[model samples]
Target: MQCRIISIGNELLIGDTVNTNASWLGNVLTEVGIDVTHIYTIGDDLATMKDILSEALSATDLIITTGGLGPTHDDITKRAVTELFDCELVLEDSVLDFIKKVFKKRNIPFSKSNYHQAEVPDCCEVLFNTHGTAPGMWFDRGSVKLAVLPGVPHEMKHLVNEKVIPKVRAINGDTEFRRSHYITTAGIGESTLSDEVVGSLVDVLPEHVSVAYLPSPQGTRIRISAYGSSDDEIDERIAPVRDHIKQKAEKYIIGEGKDLNLAKAVGDLLVEHEMLISVAESCTGGYLANAITDVPGSSRYLMGGLVAYANQVKENQLGVSTDDLNSHGAVSKPVALQMAKGVAKQLGADIGVSTTGIAGPSGGTEEKPVGTVWIGFWNQDEHFAIKAHFTNDRQINKERSGAVALEMVRRSIMGIKEMPYGFKKYPA
Candidate 1:
């Protein structure tokens, strides 16, 4: 089935709020074998909503809209939808009762706005939202299946999972199903991964089975997609290409699953090797530590971390050399190395990792530019630091630095000698 997402809000257009709803909906629909062809982001204007929604309803079999469902007068998605279908707004008693009870529990009076929220177009089926006040509406207008959901991410997600999915599945009856496997990789550029490591998929990939390289701030996710009558058939069809890619990119591959990340993969390795790890973060400001601890059961291998941002903290807490700080500056390889070794010693960890960098829109020198990062690693066998140059964007630099650190840790644990992206290691 074909789908189109209409994200309604001025906030999205004006860059105040991101259109995450459309992307989330697209992912959900695509997983269920629907091809999401168009995404429209419009303001809360009634005429624009009606026009765009009308065009969308005509364009696709399944039309999903988010936002503009609120108590305020600026919210006009419901009104526009009602106008398009030539239906009068009518209050749903069950919906009103639910809202009133919710308000009573919160000790707030049920006002006219709340009553207005309970009203839905007379022609459409009311998709009662148990979590929020705004009622989701489903319209079956001629050949189109339209579902209007709340713009709030959690609420929209809830409604989509509960109300919309079942109806979609029932309507989907015996249609083509899609199965996708996500192979995540870090510390490698997308071009190098595709051109050098994995190479072309033209010969290995079957007619419909394909791969998509999705690059992110931290890493790359290669999604292998296939369509078949059943998931089993799809998996069977996708096996050849998936296995080939896996074999080719064995060392670079973090792990399987759509959500597998560098930290999680490294955490698994630490557990398997019966080792504990600690971090001393500078420019990344505990980002590396946060990533590591974000994984479930991280306490098993993590010995906590120190955000040694200041030179004094690095000297005092992480036990960096005061002479090294004076001679080589805070973002130097020696400082990074000292921080790693000191953290391991201080925390009594089997391994320690440290990051020092200039993640900035400013504070760059002629010799040491912005995005210059030194990632240090220390263990019983080896201790080394790698210098890398990332983008000027502070957030991206921080993320990339963390990713590089984790990938190197993964490689080191796995006994691979080459640093991530073939960066030269500066060892003391």
Candidate 2:
């Protein structure tokens, strides 16, 4: 089945409001074996809404629309839909009562415009929305189904998951269900992971199996998806691709699951090894520590961390030599090495990580330009620092540095010899 999502709001086109509802619906619909072909974002003009709705209904099996469903005067989705279907607006007494009760419970006066929230086209069925006053409407025109939802994200999600999906499943009971399994990897770029690490998924995947690489600031996640009549059938179809990816990129692969973060992966590994870790951050400003502690139960393996932003703090707290700070200007290998070792000794942890860099649009020298980052790792047996050049964006540099630091911990604990991005590891 094919789906089309229509976002009706001038705010979206003008960039005042983001159309997150379309992306959410697309993901939800695709997981149920429905292919989302196109997304339409238009103003609240009644003619444009009607035209787009008509076109979408004719071309797609399912059409879902969000926005323009409020008590305000400019709200026009219900009117446009009614005009398209050549139907009259009818007040739903139950919906009206619910809206009144909601206003009463909130101790707000219900106005005449509030009645518009309860009115729907007589041709459509009301999908009761307990989350808000605006009821979602469902229209079935033989082969095509149209769901009209409110602009509020939480309300839209509630209706789609609770009402629209069940209706879609009931209608397409015989359709094959599709599911995706995610394999997440850290410390690798998307191109390297795609072309070098896990090469030619087409060759390894069986029939009806496909792969997609989703890259973010944290890491790259490979989505292995398959469609089948049963769970076993889907698993059998997806196993070969999953296994091949694991075999080729085992060193870089952090874990499986779309929601997995690199910090969480590192925290899990530290716990497994019964190791405690501390951080001394300079350019990243404790971002690495924040990322690590973002994981639940991180206290099991996380020791305290230090920001060490100023030169005095680095010298006094982390015990970096003032000579090195003056000679190397705080963004070099020697300072990074001392910071890691000092943090470990101060916190009495088994492992320590440190980040020092010029993460900025300014404060760059001829020797050490912006995004020149030094990540240091220290343990009883191993001590080294890796030099990496990232982006000019300050926030991006911070995120990438934190990711590299966590990935360094993961790779070191797993005994992977290769450095992140295959950059050479220098002895501290």
Candidate 3:
């Protein structure tokens, strides 16, 4: 089924709040085999809401709207829906009781304005909202169905999962439609990955499946979508193609589906192998360690880290030799490797990762320019380091350095001999 999401709020247009509801709804609908074709965000103007709603009903099988359901005068979604359906507004006693009980529990006085929340169109069925006072409204007009949900995220999610989806399934019934899978890869550019995949596996992909390349600063995401098939059939069709793509990009492919973070992926690998890790950070300022520790149960593998931004700290804390810093500089490969080895030995960890760079709006020279980063990793048996020259802004360079550090650590643990793209690797 094709669906369109309408987010109504002046706050969204003015940048006072983000329209996360639309993105959430789109993802949820896609998982349930529904295609979300468009998302509209508009102010709380009555005429605009009415026109958009009318237009959506004409073109889409399902229309989901969020916001403008409060008791304020600007909240006009209920009135707009009533006029569109040509139905009278009727107050629901059960909803009114629930609202009163909510206010009574909090010892707050309930006013007549709150009664507006209890009013629903005569022709619509109310979808009860257990999370909030404003219940959702469900309307059926011909073959199109419209569900009006609260703008609050938690309230909307509760209604969609508990009420709206079940209603949709009941009306449409179970049918084998389509399935989609995602393959996430990092440490490679999107254009390069696409070029590699297009040449070999594009034609071999099943007729029912289509591939899309989604690129971001983190990495490229390859989506394999299969339409008009059951779950088993879609899996059977995608299996060989997925395998071929994996083989082509095995070194670059870090994780699958929603597990895209290179740091988190490495953290999982460390936990699975029962390996411990420590880090020494310079320009990235402990960002690599922060990313690793963000995953739950990471304490099992992450030992700790030191943000040695100052030269004295690098020398005193991480044991980077003062001679190396004075001669080769802090961002040099030799210094980075020493920092990794020092931290691993100090913390007594199985693995150590370190990042040193000049991530800068300033701090560039003819020899070592800005975005010059050296990432290093050390294990008991081996040590390795790589130099990367990124040209983005300071914050982006730092983030990229952290991601690259995690990827290096992952390769080091997996016993990969060299870095991808012909980059030079320092030995232990």
Candidate 4:
């Protein structure tokens, strides 16, 4: 089934409220084998609501709208829906009784405006919401289905899971079930991974399976989804495509599961290899350490970290040479390498990683410009540093540098020779 979501509120348009309802609904609907096409966010205007509702219903077989279903005057969704369906407003006695009991329990007098909450169109079926005052409405016109729900997140979610989904399944019986598998990869850009490494999924996937490349600051999550009636059937159908991707992108793929990040991947590898690691930070501050410790059970392999932001700390704490700092500066490869090796030796760790860079809107020289990062790695066997130039945004540079540093650790431990972003390691 094809579906569209309409989020109605002046708060959403004015940036007072985020449109999280649409995203939640889209994920839920897509899991049930419904293809969600568009999401429309509009203000609480009556004419606009009616026009958008009409257009959405005309284009898609299923339409879901959330918001503007309160007792206040700004809540005009019920009115718009009633006018569009040309139905008379009728008071539901059960809903009115429930609202009255709720108010009485809270020791508040129910006013005339509160009665509006119990009113529904004569032609629609009411989906009782025990969590809140607003009742969900369901209207079926021939083949098109429209459901009007409350704007509150908890109430909407409860109604969707308890009421709406059951009704939808009853209407469309024995349909295909959808499942998705995520293959995460790092140390590569999206274009390079897609165009060169994992090219042309057409021959790899079956007719029922599809692929989507979701990119973030940390890495890219390759999603492979398929539809089937049974779990075994779905898994069997997707096996060939999944294996083909793993074979092609074996070097770059970090781990499986949708919520996997670079930190978790590196931590897992560290535990497997029985190694401990430490970090010395300059430009990225504590971001590298924070990312590493974000994963649970990180203490098993994470030794410690030092944010040596100043030259004095670099020389005093991490034992970076004063001569090298004076000659090559803090952002240079020599200082980066020294910091990594020094931290590893001082902290008694099997491996050490360091990040030194110029991340800023200001502080740029012709030779060492902004976002010029030197990431260093040191182990008992080898020690080297790689140079990377990121964006001018400080936050972006920090995130990119941290991700690359973790990926570098993962690659080095796994005996991979290539560096992140294809940058050659200095002093090779």
Which candidate comes out best when scored by TM-score? 1
As a whole number from 0 to 100, the lDDT of residue 142 in candidate 1 is 68
On the 0 to 100 scale, the lDDT of residue 394 in model 3 is 90
CA displacement after TM-score superposition, residue 18 of candidate 2 (Å) = 3.1
Deviation of model 3 at 66, angstroms: 1.6
Query: For model 2, how does the per-residue alpha-carbon lDDT over 168-210 read when each residue is reduced to its tens digit?
Result: 9998897898899999998889999999878887678788898
Query: How accurate locally, in lDDT, is each candidate?
Result: 0.91, 0.91, 0.86, 0.92
Best-fitting candidate, scored by lDDT = 4
Model 4, span 1-428: residue lDDT tens = 88899999999999999999999998888878788999999998999999999898789888989999998899999999989999988999999999999999999999998998999999999999999999999999988999999999999999999988888888768889788889999989998889899999888778899999998779899998989887898899889988988999999999999789999999999999999999999999999999999999999999999999999999999999999999999999999999999899989999999999999978989998899999999999889999999989999999999999999999999999998779888962
Q: What lDDT does model 4 reach? A: 0.92
What order do candidates take by TM-score, descending? 1, 2, 3, 4
| Ranking 1 against 4 by lDDT, winner | 4
Residues forming the 10-long window of minimal summed lDDT in candidate 4: 419-428
User: What range of 10 consecutive residues in model 2 has the weakest lDDT sum?
Assistant: 196-205
Structural similarity to truth (TM-score) of each candidate: 0.97, 0.92, 0.90, 0.83
Q: Candidate 3 on 275-358: residue-level lDDT in tens?
A: 999999999987788888888888999888989899899889888899999999999988889999989988989988889999
Error of 4 at 423 (Å): 2.0
